[model samples]
Target: MRALIIDDSRAIRMILGKTLRGIGFEVFEAGNGCEALERLQEIGRADLALVDWNMPEMNGYDFVCSVRSKAEHADMRVMMVTTEAEITQMIKALEAGANEYIIKPFSKEAVVEKIQILGLIP
Candidate 1:
C-alpha cells in the first residue's frame, strides 16, 4: 500500500515513514497542504493520507475539502492526525470528508491501530 503523510514537522514525517514502512506501506510526504496538492498533481494519488490540522498555507481541513471536491480523488482515505482533540474540530474534519481522526502523542502502535481501523493495513 501507499500513503502520503502531510505535516509541518520533518521529524514527524520521518517517524511516520519508519512506522508506515514497517507496516508494509510505501510512504510519501508533504510538509503542508500546498505541497500535498502539488505531490498529488505530479505523481498521481496515494491510497491514504495522514494530514496534520495546523499548517502554513492551506491547512488540513481545506486540503480535505479540495480532495473531496475532485471526483477523481473522492475515494482517497484521509485521516486527520492532529493535536486538536476537541469534539467540534472532529466534527468539522468529518464534515470536510476525513475518514478518521488520530490525536497526536500517540504511540506507533496506536497509529498502526488507527490505520488498520481505516482499513489502510491488515
Candidate 2:
C-alpha cells in the first residue's frame, strides 16, 4: 500500500513514515497541506494519508475537504493525526471527510489499530 504522511514537523513525518513502512506501506511525505497536494499530483494517488491539523499554507481539515471534493481522490483514506483533542474538532474532521482521527503523542499501537479499523491492514 502507498501512504502519505503530511505534517509540518519533520520528526513526526519520519516517525509515521517508519511505522507505515514497517506495516508494508511505501510512504511519501509533505511538510504541510499545500505541499501534500503537490506531492499528490506528482505521485498520482495515495491509498492513505496521515494529516496534521495545524499547518502552514493549508491545514489538515481543508486538505481533507479538498481531497474529498475531487473525484480521482475519492477512494483515498484520510486519517487526521493531530493534536486537536476536542470532540467538535474531531466531528469537523469527520464531516470534512476524514476516515479516522488520532490525537498526538500517540503510540504505534494506536496508529496500527486505527489503520486496521480503516481496513488498510488485516
Candidate 3:
C-alpha cells in the first residue's frame, strides 16, 4: 500500500513514515499542504494521507477542502495528525472531509490502531 504524510516537522514526519513503513506501506512525504498537493498531482493517487492540522502554508483544513473540491481526489483518505485538541476542530476536520485523526503525542501503536480501525491499513 501507498501513503502520504504531510507535516512541517521533520521529526514527526520521520516517525510517521517509519511507523507506516513498518505496517507494510510504501510512504511518500511532504512538508506542508501545498507540497502534498503537488505530490498528489504528480503521483496520481495515494492510498491514504496523514495530514497535520497546522503548517506554514495551507493547513490541513484547507488541504482537506482542496482535496474534496477536486473530483479526481474527492475520495482520498485524509487523516488529521495534529496537536489540535478541541472537539470542534475535530468536527471541522470531518466536515471538511477528513476520514480520521490522530492527536499529537500519540503513541505509534495508537496511530497504527486508528489507521487500522479506519480501514486504511490491513
What does candidate 3's lDDT look like per residue over 4-108, in tens digits? 999999999999999999999989999999999999998999888999989988898999999999999866678999999899999999998999888898999
Candidate 1 worst ten-residue window by lDDT: 113-122
Give lDDT tens digits, candidate 1, residues 20-74. 9998988999999999999998768789999999999989999999999999887
TM-score of each: 0.96, 0.99, 0.96
Clashes of 1: 0
Backbone clash tally for model 3?
A: 0
lDDT scores of the candidates, listed in order: 0.91, 0.96, 0.91
How much does candidate 1 score in TM-score? 0.96
Ten-residue stretch with the least lDDT total in model 3: 70-79
Using lDDT as the measure, the top candidate is: 2
Runs in model 2 lying further than 4 Å from the true structure = none
Query: Candidate 1: which stretches are off by over 4 Å?
Result: none
- Whichever of 2 and 3 has more TM-score, that candidate is 2
For candidate 1, give the lDDT of residue 60: 93
| Model 1: per-residue Cα lDDT at residue 96 | 85
TM-score pick, better of 1 and 3: 1
